[model samples]
Structure formats: C-alpha cells, structure tokens
Target: MNALLDLDQLRTFIAIAETGSFTKAAEQVNKTQSAVSMQMRRLEERVGQTIFVRDGRQSRVTDTGLRLLDYARRMLSLNAETIAAFSSDAMSGKVRLGLPDDYAPRLLPTVLASFATTHPNIEIEVVCEQSSCIHRRIQDGRLDLGIVTHGNRTQERNGRIIRSEPLLWVSSAHHSVHCQATIPLALGTKTCTWRAAATEALSKAGKKYRIAYVSSSAAAHTGAVMAGLAISVLPESALTSDMRVLGEREGFPEMKHCDIALLRSENARDRIHNALAAHIVNALDNVSGGAALAAE
Candidate 1:
C-alpha cells in the first residue's frame, strides 16, 4: 500500500490552514500555487475525500482537514524527534533557559538546583528578562526552554504551560494614601506583565495614580516599595515583614492572574528536554503549592 501522505504535503496543508489561501501557502512554502493545489489533490485522493471547503476569499478546513492538522502536528513532532534522536550528543552541552523577572524571587533557584542534581554534566545558563523577550528567545532557538509568562502555546510548538497564579498589590505597612488622591506606585518597565496588569486595572477603575518609583530590577522595585514611598504589585508569595497587601484601598481591578509557561522548542524532543521539563514542572508546582500554603 502507498503511504497516505508525505511530510511535504502535510506541511502544505498546515500552511493552508494557517494562511487560509493556497496562494499565500504557496508563497509561504516557496512552492507554486499549482504545486500546492496538486499536493492537496494528492492528499485528498489518499484520504478519499476533500480536505478544504473554499468559499470566495476564505478557505475553511473540512472535517478531514481539521483532523489531519492534529495528525500533521504529531507527524512533524515525530519527524523532529527522529532527527533529534540521532543528532543528540553527549548531554554535556549547556542548556540556556530564560525566565521572567518577578518569578525569579521564589521559583528560579529551586528549579536550577534540582536540574543541576539531575544533569550535573550539563551546564546551565539563566537569563532573566521580560515575558516577551523569553518567548522571542524560545522561538529564535536561542533559549532551549524558558519559564515564560502569559504566552499562548499551541499544540505543536506552543510549549508547556506550568503555572498560573494571581499577583496582588504590595505596599509598605504604613501606606496612608486614600481613594481620593494619586497613589504612589512602584512598577517595573512598561513591558512587564505584572506592571501592565496593574496599570490597566487602575485605568479601568479610574484610580488616580503616579509612578513614584520606576526601576529596571525587581529588587529595586521592592526596595522603593519597602521604603514606604511607593506601592507595587507582586505575586502574593513575595510578601515580607515590611510589606503587606492593601485591604481597604478600594477599587481593586479584576485582573485574572498570570500564566507562567515551561516552554521548549518543537525540536526539544530529546531526553534532555523531557527531563528538564519534568523537573521544572515538579519544582514549579511544589513552589506554587508551598507558597499557597504559606499564604493561608
């Protein structure tokens, strides 16, 4: 029996689904439109039915195309696996992992220590940056994996989402700002997920505010906040004796938590990648769970 499809045809189908046009898919895949059309034809012939339903400008996937997308992802993933399995070398190579800044306070050291114990030969490099930077590094293959924030992961290469937890407002114990005046605020740069969440919530609530302290580092933000000059937002686990959550400051916005993802490349089907993902997931779950217990 002839194989039902080739890798090239499956990839063309995914491009069509994503781009919604044979012409666009052809350009994206660097094939002629006729070639793309012929590939779809051959694919349909193998499956014994049509895979796409064309209506004017839009090309919607038929029931078959949708099912085939899942297969395509799995196929491509395994294809990647087959290449990596043979290509993988001694695990002595370093693993470059990216992380978000705020998450580092409680999560980073634990994860690194555990991974070190498991893969002592493999050196680890940690780069702490914003969530967007982490995602870009993961996509560009600069970071083998990352503990990124609020990233939307797809089935094939979207990476694994590990934790989602609420971040709360943190202020010095002596905060006296009322609901009427501008509240002194401490926040990281504009690209920060937690900072954006807090500012957007404040804008929606029409709360008067001013950035009393802006810092490049989370430690700096915490310092200004602890000095009783500004208030900052952080994960609840970041609490300290000098800092506490504001209870009566009124008009807390409904910012639904942040997602912290344990992401790796689609190419990370190697044993090293699998081991790292497992260890990181367990560490993050324990960290979040243990923090929740402490908060309670």
Candidate 2:
C-alpha cells in the first residue's frame, strides 16, 4: 500500500487552482515551476486520475480535480485547526473589531467562529456600521481593528487589501427598474464608496438617475432593490441569489472594483489582535474563490 494524499501536494494543488497558473502557484508556494510540476504529477499518480488538462500556457482542472479540490480544502482546514490548537502561544484578551454592515453578515460569523475555536480565552466584540463610521472608530482608537471598503479613487491608504470584487448594478429579479427611462437608485449615505462609484459612473455615462431610497444599512439597500423601488450598486460578494445583475446591455455603466481592506489601530499590538487578524484573513481567503489578493 501507499501513503494517502500528502498535505504539501494538496496545498500545491489548491494554490495552482486558485492562482490559475503554474508560475503563480510556484510563487505562492515558494517552489520552482519544475518542482510544482513534479508535485502535480506525483499527486495525479497517487490519486490514479488525471487532475488537470494542460495545453500550451494554460491548465484546466478536470472534473476529478474539482472533486479532489473539495476534499483538499477540508483536509487543509482541519490541519490548520490542529496546528493552531496546539501552538504554544495561547491568546487571551479583549479585541474590538468593526466592519461595514454589508460585509459583516457575509464574513464575520465564520471568521469569528474560527478564531473562537482556536483561542477560547479571547473575547471578541464586533460593531457593524457603515465603512466610513468604521474608519473613524479605528482612527479614534475606539476599535482595535476594522474591515472597510476603500473607494477606487481615495488617495488616503490605511490598510492591507485582502479582497477585491467588481461593483455591480443589481435589481430585483422580478422588477424592471433597469428598463425605466430614468434609473431609480438605492444608495447609502454620501460617504459610502459604492454610492459614490455608482453615481460617478452614471454621471460620466451621461445617464439620468435619481436616488429613490437612501439608507446606511445594507438590509435597506437590499430591500429597496428587492421591492422594485430602485437598483443599487454593490460588491459582487454582497449580492444575494435573488438579485439580478444589470450590465451594459441594460444601459448601466461599469463601475470600479471595490477593495475590502483590514486596518489595525496603532495601539493594537497584542497577540489576540494578531491571532484574530490572521483568522479573518484566512477565512476571507477561503470564501473569496481564490480571488483574495495577498495582503499588501
């Protein structure tokens, strides 16, 4: 008999699939391209199935590869948990975190759960507000860390970008607000990046639009769009299954990609903050469909 799938090989396989290029995967895993290729070949042999289809400069994961990817992710997650659980540095302290209402629901639960499991002694306090509010809280030293959206045009930089997704025009699947002569828009307050990007794009396209509804809450924006009151611009990650995306064919202008970043206060130098930040980054990377950018 032979050993089961190697953890290193599985990690490499995931990196390749996530990065979409052997060269990129090599860079990520700190291996030479030839070494990455050797690992893939060895993994394919161990599984007794063809994992990827290679052509010229491209490689596509096969159906078998997709199936293996699921198992690989699970294995790696468990492996990470085991390592974190036994690490000598047991973290304990109160960490205050803030996030935009739109992203909190989608990302906070999983990130907090993972952190809690690994650091049982740590206490986490979360505040969900508008991104602008979160930024201010961090600046005021009212929060230890924050996850906020950075506008494409904002010259002031404060954090590492962990995720980037396209800003999209979304409407109710059952409504035709997009077809209206003057587009009705549901937007957040003036400080919201999505609102600014949406209006700027519309204005540049010479399209006429009116703000039909304004709310700082993500729920309000979603509800307005779902009720056929207006279309709203949102990050692709924030969109729900029930929403329909409007594109150029629907007479909507293209908007810039929204960059979600992590900011830590200058005073947050404790082990708890570092542990929680790592967990948040890993959790987001897992859900970001391999589009999660390396923190910079």
**TM-score for each candidate, following the candidate numbering:** 0.61, 0.70
| Pairs clashing within candidate 1 | 154-158
Question: lDDT per residue, candidate 1, 1-296, as tens digits?
Answer: 36657888987876666544566567667899889888989988887777777655455677777888788866765675565556545355667778876778676655665455345556678898876777788888888888876633342246566777767777777654424378888887776767777888889888888877787578888888777778788776567767767643455665657677777865667677777778787657545222111100
Residue 281 lDDT (model 2):
75
Segments of candidate 2 deviating more than 4 angstroms: 1-89, 152-156, 288-296
Which segments of model 1 are wrong by more than 4 Å?
A: 1-91, 151-157, 175-180, 248-251, 288-296
Clashes per prediction? 1, 0
Q: Residue 54 of candidate 2: its Cα lDDT?
A: 56
The 0-to-1 C-alpha lDDT of every candidate, in the order given, reads 0.69, 0.81
* lDDT at position 268, candidate 1: 61
Root-mean-square deviation of candidate 1: 15.7
